[model samples]
Target: MTRPPAKAPAKTLAPVVLIDLAVLLLAGGGLAWLVLRAQATLPYHWDWSVLPQFLAYTAEDGSWRAGRILTGVAATVRLSLWAGALALVIGTCAGLMRVSQRLFWRLCGGAYVLFVRNTPPLVLIFLFSYFLSGQLISTLGLDAAVAGLPEAQRPLAEALFGPLRQMPGFLTAILTLALIEGAYMAEIVRAGVQSVEQGQWDAAYALGFSRRQTLIRVVLPQAFRRMLPPLTGQFVSTVKDSAIVSVISIPELTFQAQELVSATYRSFEVWTLVLVLYLALNLPCSLAARWLELRLQRSDRGA
Candidate 1:
């Protein structure tokens, strides 16, 4: 006898995903409308002669290249990359210290995190830029050393600083971003480390593993895997936070965009360009984080 026809599996549609997509599209369309409306509502007619020049950032005379916007974007990326690296190192150490058995170590780690986390990040950025960096460079004679460097060595300095020859400003911005991000990253690392079972430690110890060996061989490997998602998100946050350094005239995207608007008096046009620039840089990173999370999940499941 022939079997009855088998039914195909039903595809379940997730309502939450549809809702999220609707919200995102609505927000995007609303923002676009607002930008266009603002551009139309400008009080006076903007001179269209400079519009092409501003957009192109080059003049026929080969003298008026307004490439500071590009420079600012590059500077922002550099700051974020350095800060993210520093924060990862600092946060990992602090997190380990926080969970250590020694009371003094824990206290020190706790104090650092508490102070950084409790204070506003912007205040920290301002204080460090003006006060701490000012003192350090002066007291350490770093400025003098850089100034007194051989003419031949100036290229090395330039490579490190780019056009920013000022020692205090760049270092202050980097350290400030790192310090603020590190506090949050420390908690992330601590939680990831602690999430592993205590029995795993006991097993490693029984296998004659030293504390360091246990961490390297077993604990850290697992902890790192668990931390990847949040770590990726933190990296994107670092990129976004680098824009805050613009407050110090660090020549980041927002700063240059503001300058462009001041010069052109086309606030909407300048801001729209900057908004697109940021989306270009950040959207890829956000997508990368999502991809990494999925790959990691698949790897975890396979193992």
Candidate 2:
């Protein structure tokens, strides 16, 4: 027999559609009210037209180049990539340790997560950047070593990290972000690892795989597949968290926005543009994470 028309889905969405429209109308009205209030009571001038010019422009030689805002966007992207990579490594190791048989490993992982998650990030950044960073960098001579590099090689280092003189402070910023983000990531990893059934571990052991081999060859592969959604979401957090690093003079997007505001006094315009820029970077990652989660749900049902 032929199937009936699928009107039930539309019927189900009728209230949802109405609710969504209601929400949009309310938001629009609120924004309109704010604009009216700003015009009447506030000294702020809305000059959105001038904002786009800051994003990109032609250089003196007529070649296309990133402007102040775009340069900051690039810096933010670079910071997120480096910090996210390190956080993933730190988190994965800590996560594995959390599930380890040894008390020492477990304690170490717990302490890292507890300390990082509980402490205020600003305080931690100050300590790490001003005090600990100097001591550590001095011990390693990382900044001094980079500063002394020949002029020809300096640009490459700058491209990878930042200016040679600032690399030490920048490194500390990267480390602070990584260590803070890693605490949250560690929980994600721990949950992913724990989600794997005990039976899988037993099966691997019964097959004569060593503990390391069992985790690496069997459990982690399965756990990692499950972890993909949260991992993507965590990277979005990393992108947003990169903003605060600007306080340490990393010149990321927020820093650039602040500088533009200082120069132009276009406070609302600059901040609104920055908000949109951040959403542009984050929204895709959020959507992709949702898609991955949905796909995983479908696969589980099929299995």
Query: lDDT of all predictions, in order shown?
Result: 0.82, 0.88
Candidate 2: residue pairs that collide? none
Model 2 ranges with Cα > 4 A deviation = 1-15, 58-65, 148-155, 295-303
Cα RMSD, each candidate: 3.6, 3.7
Write candidate 2's Cα lDDT for 63-179 as tens digits: 988778988998888789899999999999999889999999999999999999999988887778787476988898886798689989988888988666777877888888999
Error of 1 at 55 (Å): 6.8
TM-scores for all candidates: the values are 0.83, 0.86
On TM-score, the leading prediction is 2
Q: Which of the numbered candidates is closest to the native, going by highest lDDT?
A: 2
lDDT of 1 by residue, 47-130 (tens): 545545544565677766647677677777878888999999999999999999899999999999999999988888889887
lDDT of 1 at 230: 88
Q: 9 in model 1: Cα distance from truth in Å?
A: 2.9
